[model samples]
Every structure is written in C-alpha cells, then in structure tokens.
Target: MTELPDTRLFDTVLVANRGEIACRVIRTLRARGIRSVAVYSEADAGARHVREADQALCIGPAAAAESYLNIAAVIGAARASDAQAVHPGYGFLSENLEFAKALEAAGITFIGPNIEALNVMGDKIRSKNHVAAAGVPVVPGISEPGLTDADLIAAAADIGYPLLIKPSAGGGGKGMHSVFAAEELPATLATARRVAAASFGDDTLFLERLVANPRHIEVQILGDTFGNVIHLGERECSLQRRHQKVIEEAPSPLLSGLDDGGAVRARIGAAACAAAASVNYTGAGTVEFLVSDDTPDEFFFMEMNTRLQVEHPVTEMVARVRGKSLDLVEWQLRIAAGEKIDFTQQDVTLEGHAVEARVYAESPAEGFLPATGTVVVLEESVAQRPGVRVDSSLARRLKITANYDPMLAKVIAWGTDRREALDRLDAALADYVVLGVPTNVEYLRLLVADPDVQAGRLDTNMIERKLPDMAFRTVDAGDYAAAALAARKVDVARPNAPGEAPAASSWGRLDGWRLGDPAPWRSAWAAPGRTGVVTVSGPQADSGTEGPGVVHVNGIGGDQESRTALDLNGTTGGELLWDGQERGYRVGMLGETVFLGSGGWSVALERLDREAATARMLAGLEREDAAADPQLRSPMPGTVTVVNAKTGDRVAAGDVLLAVEAMKMEHQITATMAGTVHIGVAVGALVKADQVVATVEPDEDNSTTIPEGE
Candidate 1:
C-alpha cells in the first residue's frame, strides 16, 4: 500500500455526491484516518454511501436540481457537518466553476483543480481553443461563443459534411450529436441545443469535423500546488454505445502493441502534461484525445475532464509510483491539503494490465432501456476473488430509480498480461448477480468475448455496428427447470393443502409420491411472449438430496419438448447438470416470479396456475384478433419532457408523439400506425414504466407518414 502523505490532511471532508463514487471516496478517507461526511437526496436515504460514511445527512429532495446539484444545499451540509473540505465526486458539481467559487467563499477547500483550470478546461469549446494555443494538436472545428442554430448551419458548408456538434458545457457524452448530411444538421442541432440547455444550463454549441474510426484515449494527470505535474499512462475507451463508454482499460492496446519501444506513449503523455501545465492545473484530471485507428501515431486533443473520471480505477490498478500502487483520490486530497510531489514523472510506471466494465441498470433486450427495481438479491462475492475488485453502490432492498444515471457499479480486474486481465474480468462479470433489476452484465460478457474485441480492433462505433449481430442468451430448459425446482421447493416446505391432512401426518407431504411410478409434479412458468410447463418426477425435492431427478419441459417459445435426468441442488444456489456440464446457478423468488442467474445472465419466470395460464392465452388471442393497441406506453419510468402532438391531432405512422427522459436518455414514443392521437400525459409529468402516455384512434384517412421533426 502507498503510504499517506506526511503533511496534515483535512480533519473532516464532505462528499458532495452519491452512489458508487461517493462510497469510493469515503473508502480512501477512512484509509487515511480522516472523517468522511456523505450527503444524499431524500430518495437515497438508505443508500450504500449514506451507510458507509462516518456522518451522513439529507441534502434535499430526490430531484438533482434541488439536491445534489444545488450548490447552496451542498455547502450548507458541509458547514453543518464541520467539513473543512468537499469532494465533488465527478458529475454533479465536480467541475462547476460556480461551485468551486462558492466553496472558496464558504472557507471550504474544493478537492479538485484550481479555479483557472476549471474555467479553462470545464467548457469544451474553450478548452479546445486553449489547448490548441498551448501547442497541442486539436480537431479542426468552428468554436465561438453564443453561436445560434443558423450560424452553425451556415458554417457546416465550410466544415464540410459529416460533422460533430458538441455542447460547450458538460461531458460524459451528453449533448453531443453527429450530423452526416446538410439536411440532418438543423434537427440534430436543435436536439443538441435542447439537451445542452437542460443538462448543463448552457445552450452554446460548436461543431467539429467528424473523425472516422476514432479511438478514444485519455491520460490521467496529477498536479500539485507547487507547479509539479505528472501523467499516469493512458486508457482505451473505444467500446461505447450512444457516445457513452462501456468498457475501459489502461495502457491502451494501440500504444502497447506498437513495436517502437514506447515512443508513441511518451508523446501522448507529454501532450497530456502540457495541457495540464497550461493552466497551472492542480489535483487529478484527465485529458482525452481522439486517435485515428488507421493512423495510430497521430492524435488530436478532444476535451479535458476537470474532475476524477469514472474509469479512474483502471489507471489506479495498473499505475505505480515508486514501485507502489497509486491512489488518485488520496493524491487529490493531499494536494488540496498543500502537499508537494514526492515522486517525479519518471517514478510512474505502468505494470501489468487492468480492465474495467461498467455495470448498468438496463435491459439490453429492450433496446438497452434504463430499468428500475428494488435490489432483492445482490451477489458481490466475486470482489473477494483474486485479481478482482468491484466498486458498487448496490445494497439489498435498495431501490434503483431512473432519476439519475444508470451506472450502478464498476467491476475491474488486473493480471500479468492483457489477455489474462481480460479473462479475469470476464470471469468476474460472469460471477456477478443482481436479482429484481435488469442489467447489462450479460451484454458486457458477450462484448468481452467478441472476436474483434479480443483482437483489440476497437472503435467508438463498434458496439453500434456489432449489436445487431450479437447473439444474446435467452431463457432455456435449464433456466425453466431451475425455476420449477425452486417453486416446488417452496411448495413442499409449506404447510398442508386445503384437502390434505395436517403437517404431523406423513400423508400430508406433497412430494410427488405414489404407489408405483411417482405422480409427476408440474408447475407453469410464464415470461413475456412465452409460457412453459415443467414437470418433475422420481424424486422428493424436500429430501435434501443432491441427485437425479427426471424433468420434462414443454411449450416455451414453441411446442418444444425436452426430457433429462438432472442433478440439481440447493435453495439459493446450486450446481446443475445441464447440456453435459454441471454449472453453478443462483435462484431467487420474489412474489410469484422466480429469478435464475448464471454466467452474468438472469431471467425472471412468473409462476402461473392453470386458470391464469388459460386466461392469459385467451387474452393474447383476443389481442391478436383486434387491431394493434393504439395506446403508447412509456418503455421506462421517467419524467415526460416533450409532448410533440397535442390531443386530437392527426398523426401518421412514425410520427413522434411524445418523449420520456430517464437516466440521461430520451426515448421518443412514436405512433406505430397512422391515427388521430390523444395525448394522455403533459410535459413534466412523472410516468411509470409501461404506463400509457398517449392513445391513438386508428384513422384510415391518415395513412401518410409524417416527416421527422414535423
């Protein structure tokens, strides 16, 4: 472990954030023997960070504007807790200049870069210009203050086709749009402006020439108040969806695989340091760059993140200073407390390989929609496994809301080589389990196992191109069998049935027993768009035996049939012999639904009786006989941000009627068929997942399709 700085650190520090980042900062504070205070919104009263801190308090309501992002509220909490410093753990107010000034006025130290650095690097447009003037290569673009839509459109001709519009404020892929043609510029620019205005309260926009096949690479840099700065290698963040990074790794494969003996790495590291030194930067910061895949040696400056990045763990795992692991958080705190560099840039070394995968609360099968649920069963035992580490904010019974970002945790792994590190990371992901809430763990596993990803052929748009061809796993016979066994176990462990004898009588036990061949015990399981019946015989589930039992599965997606003698055991977890292998699986039952988890994939099977099954089948048939349901339900829970069509408006198929914004994603609800639309929800209305937001009365006269943005 790296030793703590000799200088005196702050007695108490307030974490002006929530979720896994807050918990991570608190961990470092505890290690340094400093008091940590955590602030949370009302919706996060029972959050993991709140429970982990030495002292905790409610900042405000669940809305970020009224709570986490409210500078006054965070300062007030810090004052009340007697905190000498505040750590805005990336996102909320981490790089907000006003927040930093307010902290200075309140006599509290801001554990981040200096005001000059924040002002220069916090805005993308300004940072690009500033870095270019500082002798750093930057992407060709038009970046001016207060550029209107008309101005941007006019400049597109000069910038050429295929351009990128980026918001002046905010990072993490928010408020960025790619326009491939002149006609697409107007609408895409409008969206970029709206997102920028709402997310960062700034509508200033700029355009950049879209680089083809670009690989995102960022270098981690740390500085001290004494004007010393050093860089800790780079991270590869090429795998992304919708501009948000999904996987990140240190010592980028592009540079590491080169035959030139670390010359390119040195050049990139020098550029990152130069960017930091331009503004006398202090604390930990990241300088991101766009490197073309075809021209690996050439790179251009993207933007600098003025706060600690979410992918900092990958750097920390592989970066070493003076032959010891480095902790970026500790350095940030120490620098804020007036400490000088104990080691020079030459002391930093990249040892081994480290990879990190972000675990998001989303449903990949549902177009990667943000999902919510109370965490019923969370298995993080993999964190204790060798070469693995998990940074998470998950707790059993903790509710996941769509009010914030969908990222719930990050699982990181390290090994002696890149392949070994990747294997370890994949294994760690497979061992992860979260019941009740849907996640992208399985998708991440598949991505890791992809041929191109394994061979290090990556680009920012690779996920979008590969998603359609990726074969995601679905519920199979093994999953159905596991659910049925769990349900049967619950039944056999219960009291006697209505017509059966009391528990004291041996005959009361419903263990599928009979005179000769045992009577088969059957259970009906239903999922969305599919139903199945699993029958088990030749064994007593309550006998505590881990042996053979005959099982037959029928009618899941079709009239399919399967019969096998399975060896399944345990209540919460067990080893199941399926498809010629005995694989471990986890089981959790909530209400009437049984959840089976294996290899980082989980499926929920709702239990149904004969009557319910028959009724469902009839209802499905009735729906098939009638025209499509005109009602457009919200795919995910969120606040309605825009209602494009008012009530009684004649809309055609593919017309966007409304939009729901959740987890930083805006899902537009469109008309599936031409009809007269009746809007059900207005702007700013909170909606639940699957709640009808609008209804359309089919109109044969309105058969024409509406143009986009009409």
Candidate 2:
C-alpha cells in the first residue's frame, strides 16, 4: 500500500438520491459529525429520507429523468447547500460520467470513483475490453461500438448458440436477453436494441457466451487515492428473476463449502483488485464475476460497479477490520477526502455469515408485476430484533407509485453461520408487514426456505426453474374471517338507510340488533380474482373471553360454506383456527377494505355490494363464453411508452397493442383476440394498474396479421 498525505474530510455532503440508500448514507454522515443534505422530487416530498436529513430541498417533479436524474438540479442542490461533496447512492446518476464531470466542474468532491473509472467500467463493452487488456479473465464475448444488426448476425455464428445479448450501457439487468438457438437471434436483437435505447439512451449492444449453471459472485472492494485497495470477501447473488437479483448472501456458500475455498477466494479477490487497479478506482466499488457452479475455482470478470451497491450491508455485517466492524459508507467518505487506508488485505477477516432479501413492491404470483398503493399499515419493528437489519423507505400513508423502482426495502440478517443467517432472515421477513400494497415478502420467505436454497444448490436459473413449483399462499378463509371481524369491530358511525330516519334512542340500533339476540349480519368481501362472504351472529363488541367462537364463511367461486373459529379480544386482529392450527394475524382498515397480515403474507379484502357482485358474475360469464376477452389492461401502474396499434386497426391475437413501463420494467399489453383494436391511451401517458388501456372488437374475418419487420 502506498502512503498519502492526510486530507480533511468534507464538512457537509449532499445525497443525490432517494429512498433507503440516502438514509443509509446519512446514518454514517451523522455518526461522523458531518451535516447531511437530502434532495427529493415532488412525489417524495414526505419521504422518510427527507424527514431524516438535516436539510432537504426539492429539485424537480416525480419523473426520475426530470428530478433524480437531472444533473443540473442535483448540482444546484449541492451548490445551494454549500456541500463540499455529493454521494450518488447507487442507481440514477451514480455511474454517469457526465454527473461526475459536472461535480468536478462545480468544485464539489464526488464520493465515488474518478471520472476515468466511470468511463471505462460504466459500459459493458468498454469494461470487458479494458479489464481483458489488464490480464483479467472475462467471459468470451464480441464487443464493439456502433455494431449494426447485420454485423451482430455475422458474429453470432462465431460466438455459437446460448449467447447472452446485453446492452453496453446501463446496469441492473435491464436490456439483457439469452438466446439458446440461432433462430432466436434476429428478433431478440431488435427487442434488446429497443430496450437499451429506451432505458439507457444507448443502443450499443454486445454478445457473450452464456455460462450454463452460472453463479454470480461479486467482491466488495474499497480503494483510496493512495493506490491502495483491499477486498472484503464475495457475495453469492445467483438467485434471481429476469436477470434481477432477489436474494444475496455474503461469504458465498459455494466457496466456503469447497476443499480449497480459501485459495480460490484469494485468487478471485486478487483478480477483482486487479480490475479496480486497472482504472485506479477509488472509493467503494464492486467487481462482479461469473463463476461456474460446477467449477468454483474458475471465475471470469463480469463488470465493475463504480458506486456503493444495494447489498453492501451484507458485506458490512460479516467483514471486520482490526477486530472491529466496518462501515463502507464511512470509508467512501474518507477515501474521497484523500485519506489512505490504514488496514491491509491480510488485516480483513470474515467473522460470520449474512443474508439479504430485497423487499420489492410487486406481485410474484402476477408474473412479478409491479404494484401501486398507499401504505396503510406498517410493521417494521422486526428490525429491532436480534440479528435482524432492515434498510427501508416505507412509511405509513406512503404512496407506492410507479414513478420509481419497485424495491421498497431490504431485510438482512447476521448469524453464527449460513443456516442461522437464513433462519433469521426468514423469521424477519415473516414478521415484516406492509399493507395497502402487494409485496414479494411471502415469495421471499418461500425462497429462503427452499430445499435447494438451504442446501446451497444455487445458480442463476434456480429461482426461475423453481417458481413453477413454489406454492405462494394467498387469501384464504383466515383472511376473510379476519376482515369480517375487523369490519364488525369498527366504531365509525353508519349513515341512515335510504329514506329511513336516524335512530330516536340508543335502543334503536341500526347495526342489525334485536330484542332477544342480534341478528346475523352478512358482509361480502372481494379480493383480486375471488370473492367471499362471512356471516357473524355473535355480539358486535368484544366478549373479553379466552375461548374462541365460530363464523360461517362462503368459499370463493363456490357455494360450499365452512365454519372458522376465531378469538376476537377487541384487538386489531383475531386468532383463526385455520389449516389445523391456531394462527394470529394483524389487521388494519383502509377505507372499506380490510388488510390482514401475518407471517409476511397480506391480503386486502374490499367490502363488496350486491350490485357489484352481480356485475362481476356477469363478467365472469362473459369470460367463460369467450376464451379471449379482447380487453387489454395495463398489468401495472406506469407510463405508457409505446402504442403499437391505433383505433380501427385490424390486429391478430397476441399482437402487442401498447407497453406500460414502471420501475424500469416494461409490460406489454397485447390483444387477446383477432379483431379491430381501439387504443385508449397514447405514448407518454400515465396509467394505473389493471386500468383498461385498449379494447378490441372481435372480427375474425377482418383480422390481419402485422408484418414481421413492423
């Protein structure tokens, strides 16, 4: 390690990001006695990060491009706050060369790598070539600038089948495709190009030979201006969906389970250090590698992330420096101030095991569709428990919209070993609750408890392969019973019946009360794709008894009814004797809908009226009559970016009518039947989840197919 002159750290730093990462950075800044400034958009005015920051300023509106990604606005915020430095906490402009350059021009320190490192490592094509020149092993690939489709087609034959198509620009698994056969090249290339252009504004693409049963391992490295860099072990991130990581763990189980694990670890760590040294990388960075699960000793360099990573907490939990835990954020701040690292590579040690699960606001059962809703109930108290850590941006009444990423928070755990860490993580998730918005919490719990996952049988495609077999628990009799009981317990005043006068006395109750016994009150409840009713005959008020009573519930989509025993002790929720066991749940009401949550699973049951129920039945009948409904609805709330069909356009079934993009994920709305299409939305228009964006009138005789090239 090279020695360097001492330099004072910045007095204040402006965080050019939002959500949990910003709050995470502020925590270290506050510990170091540095003032932290937060910048947010119009949509995040009341966000948790803003409230926690010492100073906050509004930069722009909700659109990320105009707000979080606005280079001018972010720089202006830093300038106005007299911030000596700015921390681009992952995502947004974290790795943008222009943002770093602008900060340099503004005389503010960039709490990340220098511009040179960003330029080389930011683009996949350039980084591969740059590191390859430095004698680093990289996956076999064809990379070049301005490679036309024709050129790629010619090169595909040489690269062979099972090749990965990746955009040169952007990160986070966007615009990535895998082609297993030659016949799938042309169309896939076109789609990849379009996504690349839309996402990163750069259509430059490259191809690499896909490593079968590949495992993603990334080393956490910290570098200083003194030309010193050290690794903090590796993280296993093989469990993913659609190329996005769902779960990550530190001190990869594959390496730890190997006979020569320490030797392989040293070699991989050295290669990562070389990759960073090639560009003189400074501050905290991650060097991702593609390691074959069959041969753990052999690893290939993938890419170098130029900023702090979302899974850095896992590394922090297990990495100790000089017998003390390390804070990567603090090191980033210190490195940016020209301070030299006092510890060497041999001084770093891994103590225990840690695991992290990303809590995304998505419906895993609905093809991982992004969800939108206002957070009505929150139960993040699990973070205070032993061995559990939660980095979240969730707050009560927080509106989870489609304008930003779907990641709501991250739950991490540290234990004596891998099994203990996984156990803690699963328990934390089960205790975690976020109602009013659908989340993948239940799916995450199922994943951690998977047999293959627990056995360390991990690969990039494991999650995708196991999804078909994973049984995701949804709304059941317990959910309906809890909703009905919660509704009965509500004390809100009820309006008089139509043309009926208000009660003259307390004896004249409007709540189905009688002289001898209160009549049973039946209420209908509806969830997505299902509806049920529950009848309660007992007293509306709590009995204050330990014994449980029973309520009859009509199963969804069936006439069969069953009795469910529930104990309501005047609490927000009740204990349900369900699935041959007594289970407890927490319940809250948002409007007429009751949200019940337990064991990391939640459901929103809405009070349904008789007229609405009848209409729903009629719609179900229509669906039964025609297999194709002709209605194209936006699967998620987002902005409509592409409108492929216009009104009166004859289209064939499976033709894409429009695309709605939210949280960087695009879901195409397709015509269900051959017909004349009527597009209801245009380009750049905001849409709601499940909102009807287009409709098609079935006309099989007049339907026409779209040209392949078009």
Candidate 3:
C-alpha cells in the first residue's frame, strides 16, 4: 500500500456535464464537503443538477455542440467559479483526449485517466491495436486507418457476412450497425458514417466479425499514480438494445458453470488488470469484453471505456472499499491529485450478487423509439434495506427532451444471492414511478420476470428475441378508471389557472344535479387518442362530497362493457383505490395529465373531451380523402435545423422528412409510409412536439397531389 498525500486533490470541482451522472458525482463531492460548480445549456436552465450544485453557469444553448461539448466555454465557467478540478461525468466530454489536455494545460485537474491512456484507449481501433500487441485477445476485424468505402466493403467480404460496422471514435451503440447481408452494407454504412460524424465529429469506422449472441462482460478497475491497480470483478451486461446495455449485474451470471469454479472469472479479471497496466492507466475505467456462448472460457477484448461506467453502482454494491465510504468518483479525484491507492489487488473482494436496471424514458414496444415529455410526476421508493439504490436526475416538472440519451433512472439491488438480488431488483422496479411520458418500465418488469433472464440463459439478442412475446403488459379496465379519475380530479381542482379552456356547462355539471340540488352529474370523458369515453360520473366541487365517485368505464375495443368498477371518491393525497382490487395506489396530476402510480409502475392519462378522442381515433382509421397527402409532424419538441426531403422527392418508408434538434440530440422525423415529400419547415425554425413539419403524398399513382412551390 502506498502512502497518502498531504495536499487535497481539489477543494472545488466543476462538473462539465449535465443529467443524472452530473448529479451522481455531485453527491460524493457534497459528502466530502467539496464545493461544486455545474454548467448547463439553455434547455437545462432549471435542471435538477443545476440546482444541486453550489453554483452553476450557462455555457450555450440546448445543442451540446455549443454547450457541454464546448470545451472553451466549460473551462471558462470553471475558471469563473474558481474550480480547481473538472469532472466529466460519463458522457459529453468524459472520454475526450483534448478535454484532458486542455484541463491539464489550464492547470486544472481532469478527474480521469491521464491524456496518454485516453489517447491510446479512447480510439476504438487504436486501442484494439495497442491491446492486441500487448497479448490481449481481440475480435477478428479490419481496422485499417483511412479505408475507403470500397476498401471497407472488400474487407467486409473477407470478414464474411454478418459483420459489424462501428464508429472508432465513440461507443454506447451510437453509429453501430450490424450487416447481416451484402445488400444491407451500402445503406448501413452510409447511416453509420452520418451518425458517427454527428455524434463524435469523426466518422472513422472499423469492421468486426459479428459475434452472434455473445455475452457482454466488463471488468471494473481502479488505479493510482504509484503503479498500483486493482480489479473490482466483472459485470454481466448482455442485455442490450441497438448495442447499448439495458440491464447489468455484477459477478456475471453467465460465467457460472457446473464444473468451472472461478477460473474464468480470474482469467478475465487478470486480463482486465493487464489491459489497464499496459496503458499505465490511472483512475476509474472499465475494460469491456465479448465472450462467445459456445466457448465460455474464451473472451475477446471489445473496447475499454476510460471513464466511470454508467453501471458502476452494480460493481460498487458488490465490492466494498474497506474502512471507507469512498466511491469511484472519489477514487478518481484522489488518483488525479497524485494520491497513491492505499489498497492493492489483494484487498479487493466481491461480496454478493447485485443487479442494475436502467429505466429509460423511451418506449421499448415502439421500436424502442425515443419519446420526450415533461415529467408530471416523479416518485421514488426509499430503499430501507441495503439492496436498493436509484440513481436519477428526474424531478417533477423536469422536461426529458430528445436532445440527449433517453435514460431516466437506474434501479440497482444487492442481495446475498442472485435470486434474492433479482427479487429486490424486481421490487425496486415495481416501486419506481415516472409519468407524463412513455417508459420501458413495464417492459423491463416483464423482462426481469422472464424465466430466461432469471435462469441467466442470456445473450445480447435475448431482449430482441423475447420482445415479441413481451408485448407491453395489458392495461386493465381498473387501470383505465384510475388514470381517468386522477386526470379528471386535476381538471376539477383547478378552475382559474391559465391556459385551461373552460368546459361547457352541460359537460361540466354533475349529473342528477340542478340549481341548489344534489345531483350525480354524468359527462363523457375520453382517453387521449383512443376511441371510447369512460362516462365518468361524480358530484360537483361545491357539493357535500365534492369529488369524482364511481366511474363507469366502457370496455376497450370489444362488445363487453363496464370492465371494472372504481370507487375513486376519495383518491386524493396522491392515491387511488378501485372497488374490487386490494392493491393501494399513489396518484399525481399535472393539469389534465394524471400519472397513476404504485409499486414502481405508472401510466399517464390525458383528460380529453369525448368528441376529441373519438375524432382523433376516426382520423387514424379513415384516411378518407385518398388524394389528400398526409402531413409529417414532429413527434417530439425541437428546432427544425435541417430539411432533407424537398417537394416531389420520392421516398420510401422511414425516409428522413426533416431533422429536429432537441436537448442537443438530433431526432430525425422520418416518413411512416412511402411517398413523395412536401417539406413545410426550413432550417433554423423552432418547432413544437407534434407540430406539422412536412406532408407526404401516399398515393404513388398520383404525382399531382402536391402543388408546385405553393
């Protein structure tokens, strides 16, 4: 064990990122009594991270290019606040070699591995070359620098069919594509290049043989300036979507076999430590690998993330630092300050099983499409036991925009065994509630509860394979009643608030009530964007028992009516109770949007007029005017910065109609059906969610559907 330094690493630190990871680092800084500074973009003017920090500065607008990625602005903010160190929390500038160089030149500590390791390991291709030369087993691929499209295609042919194209400059599945056939290469290559350039400013790419159904295993390591390094075991991160991990567990379940006792785990850990030592790496970093299913003993070096991983909690939960409450961020801070790690590899030990589930704001059922909306209600369950931890940046009134990754919260659970840890994780997932936008919580619930996941019969493609069987859990009539009742309760509670269009007296009055008489007023209430009204009936606010009572919700999409009876009379203080069910609920409402939540599962309902919901449903079914071209709308709010398709441009389904920039990420509005396009917006036009940006003529036979330039 090396000795400690007398001087503190940094008295004040500036976090050069936003969202949950920023807040996550701030937690340790606060615990250590270190003053923290935060930088935010215009979109995150009121972000939770901004409020949590001791001080904050605005860098640029919503786009990350002008803000979080704007190295100069971040440095200026840090200097202005007199911060001694900068923590790039897991994204944005976390892995940028230039950022580290800039911070070093500016005489401010960069709380990560030094610039040398970042340069060598940050570039995927270069890292592979370096590690393989150091005797690490790497995946078979073509990684020649400056390869042309033809050269890449020829290399792909040599690598055989079912190759993967990945951006050399970035990870997190961005700009990564799987080419299963020769025909898919051209388009896949084009899209990959575009995404790579947009995401990392460098479109340098590499090709690799696609390891089918391989389990993703990554080892966490901590190193210090004194050449001492330690491994914190491995995390099973096989479950992924589009190459990004969704769920992660420590002490990899996949590595457990009947006869092999810890040999494979030891080999992988030593390989990881060797990989780190080869780079002379310091601070917290993750070395990732892809182990083939058939040959469980063999593992190939995938890539090394030279920053704290998003799933670090799973490793932290399992591996406890003796005699310290320190986490990875703290270790990074100490290591950056030239402090030696007090413990060696022999001091570290994996205690028990732990699991982490990433609860994203995106909908898994809808092609895992990114959805953005205001968080109307955010409720987190307190983990009384040591097993549960939720790392999140969500707060009520927080707006989840499309300009960034759609991850909302992470639910982590630790237990004495795998089954107990899984049970705790499932309970935590059920208790995590988020509303006002679609989420993958329910899907995640079904996923963990699946037998294959429990048995650890998993791979990268398991989620995709099980998705068809895991269509979103059916919403019961009682669920509908609860959501509707909650939404209506909000509407009835607020009468004088602005932006609320007053409803007509006929629809507003309680059924069975006239002037000065007690009557049960019945009015039709509709679920937003659906067909039938629940026909909710309750007393007026001024009446004795002024609240929603019995709701006679009609059956959904069938002849059967009155699906469930709900006694929503006293569903207040954020709770709802149905007549038949025994499960108690907590409810929250924002304007007409209500989030009914309980046990970590939540659903959002919009209070809609019976006529409006019916009208919307009819419009979808009856594209009656075949001649009238359908309009393309922005599904999420953002500024229209690019319109690719012009009028009369023929396009197939999924063609980019336009690109909207929100929360620093570009959400391309693509065509749902094949058609000729008539773009409505120009570059630099700010657009709202669902605002019409273009129109498409679906009738292939009709060329004259769109007027010329008018």
User: 152-263, model 2: which lDDT tens digit per residue?
Assistant: 8899899888899999999889889999998899999999999999999999999999998899999999988889989999999999898899999999999999999999
Q: Is candidate 2 or candidate 3 better by TM-score?
A: 2
> What TM-score would you give candidate 3 relative to the actual structure?
0.89
What is each predicted model's overall lDDT from 0 to 1?
0.87, 0.86, 0.77
Clashes of each: 0, 0, 15
Provide the lDDT at 263 for model 3: 82
Regions of candidate 1 where Cα sits further than 4 Å from its true position: 495-502, 506-520, 537-550, 560-570, 577-583, 609-612, 623-627, 700-710
The model with the greater lDDT, 1 or 3, is: 1
Error of 3 at 322 (Å): 5.0
Better of 2 and 3 by lDDT: 2
Q: Model 3 clash tally?
A: 15
lDDT of 3 at 309: 94
Expressed as tens digits, the lDDT of each residue in 381-430 for candidate 1 is: 89998889999999988899998999999999999999999999999999
Model 3 worst lDDT run, 10 consecutive residues:
558-567
